[model samples]
Target: MLRTSLTFILLTIIFSSQKPKKNGVKDLFKESFYIGVAVNGQQVSGKEAGALPLIEEHFNSLSPENGLKWSLVHPKPEVYSFDFGDAYVALGEKMDAFTIGHCLVWHQQVPNWVFENESGEPLDKDKLLARMEDHIQTVAGRYKGKIDGWDVVNEVFNEDGTFRESKWYQIAGKDFIKNAFRKAYEVDPAAELYYNDYNVWKASKRAGILKLAKEMKAEGIRVDAIGMQGHYTLGGPSLDEIEKGIIEIAEAGFKVVITELDVDVLPRPNNSEGADLNINFANSPEYNPFVNGISPEAEAKLAQRYADLFQLFQKHKDKITRVTLWGLHDGKSWLNNFPVRGRTNYPLLFDRDLKLKEDVFAKLKVVSKQ
Candidate 1:
């Protein structure tokens, strides 16, 4: 009996001494890539006090959710707001996290006055280009040396790989894209520049992006990475397509960053895809069946989906630099209102109470080991 007890104690000691399991997402993937999260103004400013501890523990990189957007930051031609932006940068510094500037040019959320003349007509090419340069220089320049990278342009290409006929395109054509990158580089040459977009898993859209990246490279513009927005659903965009997109982008000699990743588990209204802010559907019971909370079966599916994605990310860790989730927790997910309004969406690694989804997190932890 004494011998048996001694053996059990020895086994317990051996197991306990082996090594504490890595629980933090950043720690699990420390050797793979930077794990990141986007923060809103409240989170950065201590208004969302619960989030700061979670952010510091699990994420090694930071991206401002809406504070850095042109509409919010600049608002009008003569006015510029930096309170939230300053707080955001300060939070990154305090956490020693890799800081990212969201974007310099995007069609959505930009003020109409940016494209209009004093008479409220469209500005010509030269005037528009000047306006673009001024905005880029002012914004990018303010955060110069502080921000590690900048999404110089975003979602400029359609799914067919054609340039979106946004006001930027309509006024200045492709020069707006090139000039945006150029001005950002001029302001902060040390910062890595990126072109960010969604639905890049589509072959045509991926091709268009690669073509543009190559064109910019050939023309001596500095583009350090391509930000593939991984706003996925549990149902579509086969893993093969996502893997192919990552391989192709890396093979083309650019770092691939999985930006704004979230897996929506809710039913879609019209089977919509991608992260287009304009895509909105009226809320209904059928579309939001999980008002009380996600079903156990659906939650299991979400865990597996996140596990598979992390496995893929781990497999290609050498090619990917950063993987940033769009928001810190489900309660704050833009998915809650996006595509369908007033519907509760469980689309992040954390639950509504700011607790990590243990099942999903465990699966992801196992993926890191694999």
Candidate 2:
């Protein structure tokens, strides 16, 4: 009996000393925060064969890419399409992932009919306000318990921090933001409500969001989180800026979410900006320098960039609830066709084959350990 016990004790010590195998992004940040990814219809419906497996393996949260937008979900005055959105919720449930609604109100991707009446006249204050309430209640109510959170309003302010002259502002005034959150809470008080926007690292935009959050709080609005759209580039938004921006929002007493994250690795047609979806230019050799592929040097830089940003994320994990990649893989990223068409941009953790990029996760794993 003593001989057998000694052998078992030795085996247990040997097994315990072995290093644990690294698996997925979610695993790397398991204690820090949930790792999330946005999924299009193809990915949700299993048409993107390889992506769903990666999503199931790595991601613990899912956001619908254009699936839950106003025009796509509630297009006509009397209609609501739950097909795609429902599928997304179902998939999230199956994976036991946190499902988030991209947005409830935004200037872009909304139908013109929303702002017009039968005579094509713009909606007055009362009519527009009613329309907003009905839409939020119905859409948010449909998946009340299923969806965990929402981008209650998106991109309402420009880069300079002034409110955009969107029709929502024109019709409902600034109270449109407050009203949207109120209605969402009324229908689904359990769901987390967030004000999401881009360019939040810039001082002006960050101030604008803080101002909005302040107003909402004073009025007893339910602003649960502030989402900074992490539409980053390879070289900009230094680690200091990312840390500062996240700390700024967390300091405002709001949980921060890194939403819509993707690193663009190509030369911009307009060098002054990053991921301006509005910009459309003629394709040229100047813009599409990496027609064949991103050089290995650029790939290494991309991995290092992610490692550095994730290091910051881990450091601030207490305030950050989730970190979501914009898309599943390079082939599916909107960066491929935006600004200039037919340009191959490597902007995601996974390559076209749905495999891990060269040494990307390995480098990230080392950072996570640190």
Candidate 3:
């Protein structure tokens, strides 16, 4: 454990922007990456308006991937709920941050009651497509020019590069993805529409989606960007693999976003065999997930891992436009209850106390290039 930490820190000294250099990573974000967050509107620590301060501090954008979904937007059918979206947009405007409306269609967040038939089955192709059109138009129309982009479709791909089995796919057929973008464009042709998903960096997976995008363009539909949901686990993929994927996606002529970024530390990783709850993702979201705890040595190497990735972002700034962290701090992070059930995962830029974790601050300094 000590050896790994030492190696990472040593690399940070060499790769970090802490070195006295002009035109470093920080300078780069001034134009691109408009650092942002995936935030929720839940009450937090006596401050019901959560994560707003962090947004003001570091981000130039805010994306409510789940908050802006169908259910959240319209909890009761036909009674639109602008309370949550309003608060987020107001904060973004006040902070001079770009607000991104995360999705128009998602299989998970929408209530099953709306999309089903009278018999409790889903609607037919025609009805399904019309319902989708109505929903997208209403939501995107309400926000219209204010939103920077929309992940019109989210996570449409299975991990092994297969199209997900969704109701949109079932009723509207393969045209569901294209139609979602079309509806978004129809509501606000000006607002950017994108296909957002995870694990897209893999060669075969990226290729499959790129081919679909090409076909969509051929059919006169516009897919303005591609969002890479960067929910990374320990040993998920190599740095080289991740870097290459970013370059290729940009090369395919779609804007790329690191939409939902996280690095999980769970099941103790079994190597160092630290105490079950010793390493708190809440304290440091970017702790080397593969490693067990935070040390001067681990801190250094984790810094480098962040630095190296930021370097990639720097290299492809022309192609990549935004790199939004999953959350502002560990306090309100969904990682706390996701995938592990009763496990707290820290995989973000700030700790629960709101101070920058060594890894997060170091990475920000790298991205800031100061």
Best by lDDT: 1
Q: Write the per-residue lDDT of candidate 2 for residues 21-42, one digit (tens) a residue.
A: 5488899888888899999999
Model 3: lowest-lDDT 10 consecutive positions: 269-278
In model 1, the runs with Cα more than 4 Å from the true position are 1-22
Of candidate 1, the 10-residue stretch with the lowest lDDT total is 19-28
Candidate 1: lDDT of 112? 98
Relative to the true structure, candidate 1 has a C-alpha RMSD (angstroms) of 5.8
- Judging by TM-score, tell me the better candidate of 1 and 3: 1
Estimate, for each residue in 296-324, the C-alpha lDDT of model 1 and write its tens digit: 99999999999999999999999999999
The CA lDDT of each predicted structure is 0.93, 0.89, 0.69
Candidate 2 local lDDT, residue 294:
84
C-alpha lDDT (0 to 100) for residue 152 of candidate 1:
91
TM-scores, each model vs. reference:
0.94, 0.93, 0.81
| Number of the candidate with higher lDDT, 1 or 3 | 1
Q: Which candidate model has the greater TM-score, 1 or 2?
A: 1
Provide C-alpha RMSD values for all models, in order: 5.8, 5.0, 11.3
Cα distance off (Å), candidate 2, residue 336: 0.8
